[model samples]
Target chain A: MRMTDRPSNEEGALAPWFAAGREAAPLPSGEFMARMEALALESQPAPRAAPAAPARQSRGPGRLLARLRAMGGWPALAGLTAACAMGLWIGAAAPEAAVDWVATATQEQGLSGLDPASGFDYAMLGL
Target chain B: MPYDAMTDTSDEQLLAAYAAGAPGAARALTARLGPLAFGHAFRMLRDRAEAEDVAQEALLRLWRAAPGWREGEAKVSTWLYKVVSNLCIDRMRRRRGGFAALEDVAEPADPAPSAAARLQERSRAEALEGALAALPDRQKQAVVLRHLEGLTNPEIAAIMDIGVRAVESLTARGRKALEGLLAPRRADLGYEDD
Candidate 1:
């Protein structure tokens, strides 16, 4: 209370008794405190279980294997086999120019066959 | 939390920590709030056993509410006081139409050395308690919360779920009643010298 907000005479008269009441405010018995403590602990919600460690994700070599498995194991292998057979067929029966280009790709890796000067050469021959 | 730090922690934080299973949080909260609930219940009911039961019940509700407690919505102390005030009201209603005898009031929770030394103060406290017991429950509660408990009128209004003016009125009327009740004993209680 501030000096300006002084208590009325009745309030002042009653103040000491209130102070006594405050001083005499009951103390919870040890047994009561223990029971409350037990209740508090018992009622406590378990600390939200730490978010379950993110499910271990398969990585490294297992990643590709997992993807292949996801794509349906034997069907994915069959697709690769079919693609390889197509490449073998191209190798066995393709034109000589295609074979030469393939040779160029594997050997010098040069692409002069794709150069614009070759277009001019074709124009000169009118073919 | 260290023992010292828990004293500084707000009730909501302590409750949140308790809900989250922080060690020592339970005891710390109990230490902070137990006496308050018990004291208010004791003063209102003036029966040690019933007051204890009411205090336990009030704190039990608090424990149950811990998990869902939201800060900034309501104060923990105010909530507990409100619960206690209501619980006391319910208890008093169960025994309505009968007034308590002066001897039925319980003794001081802890008899302080100073209080025991000053017999006059103890008599005055007893006299006031007896006078308070005679007031209507609402008036008694208002007066107790306002004067004995030293709470603000608005806080008492919230606890009692009444308007501030109503609190002021009840307290004023209650004190007047108490003065009337205690007037005869004033000379005997040593007010003449003051």
Candidate 2:
């Protein structure tokens, strides 16, 4: 932006060489631009859908690896396979599986005991 | 809104709009800039196919960067010049002896008379490319950016990440060397034949 910032060489000297190049040879057509536009259009990422809060899937050994593969293919598959296998093996050796806590807790709490008409604790005996 | 009217819009503006879901903005941006970028690649690399490949890669990068683009810093062309220049330099470095050979100098024969002339023109272009390749890396870039690509000194300095005075010195050195190297074929280049 400052004159001091510019090149010390005079522009008039360059004008002749550039003028000769342009006059003797002007650049060709605009085809290259068209091609670049096509490439840009093709490469643009698609718009993302609104976040619906993805339903949580219970984590499993291969889950992360599979998702990674879906994004990056073979490179990811090679890097993730051993880790995923180890995770799966560890999971298979676990003594107990994770519980359906929501359903189990609801049933165990016996809040289902209040019958509207009878006012009875129907779930008191774990029936 | 019409895209031509969008010409005044900066690349950062268009990229942001494109990321925001305006496909037209992307189209306009590329259409406006493609040739200049491609021409730079072509002249710098001296290979149409390679230039096209570089142009495609650079454009793809533009799209990929659109979403997180921050504006008001670098001009898009300046960024692009840096990207493409680095790519060309990388390619040149990868191929052993790919740079210009000063010893390979040959006089360019007149092209327009016969098959010999055409061959001469091709060889001349190759020789010029080689002489250019022989220059120091910084000089070659300075020459390509300033002369062949028609960028101004300050703009070239920005792209090369150097100061303007450095750009001038580099270009002067580059031109002196090129003229000396090509001095034998000045006639072939339409300069006064030595």
- Best candidate, TM-score: 1
Docking class of 1: acceptable
Return the clash pairs for model 1, or none.
Answer: none
Docking class of 2: incorrect
Please give the DockQ score of every candidate, comma-separated: 0.39, 0.13
True-vs-predicted CA distance for residue B123, candidate 1, Å: 2.0
- In candidate 1, how many Å is residue B184 off? 1.9
TM-score of the B chain in each candidate versus the native B chain: 0.89, 0.78
* lDDT (Cα) of model 1: 0.79
Interface RMSD (C-alpha) of each candidate? 2.3, 5.0
When summed lDDT is taken over every stretch of 10 residues in candidate 1 chain B, the lowest stretch is B102-111
Residue B45 in model 2: shift from native, Å?
A: 1.0
Q: What local lDDT score does residue B15 receive in model 2, on the 0 to 100 scale?
A: 73
Question: Any residue pairs clashing in model 2, and if so which?
Answer: B100-B133, B100-B134
Per-residue error (Å), model 2, residue B126: 7.6
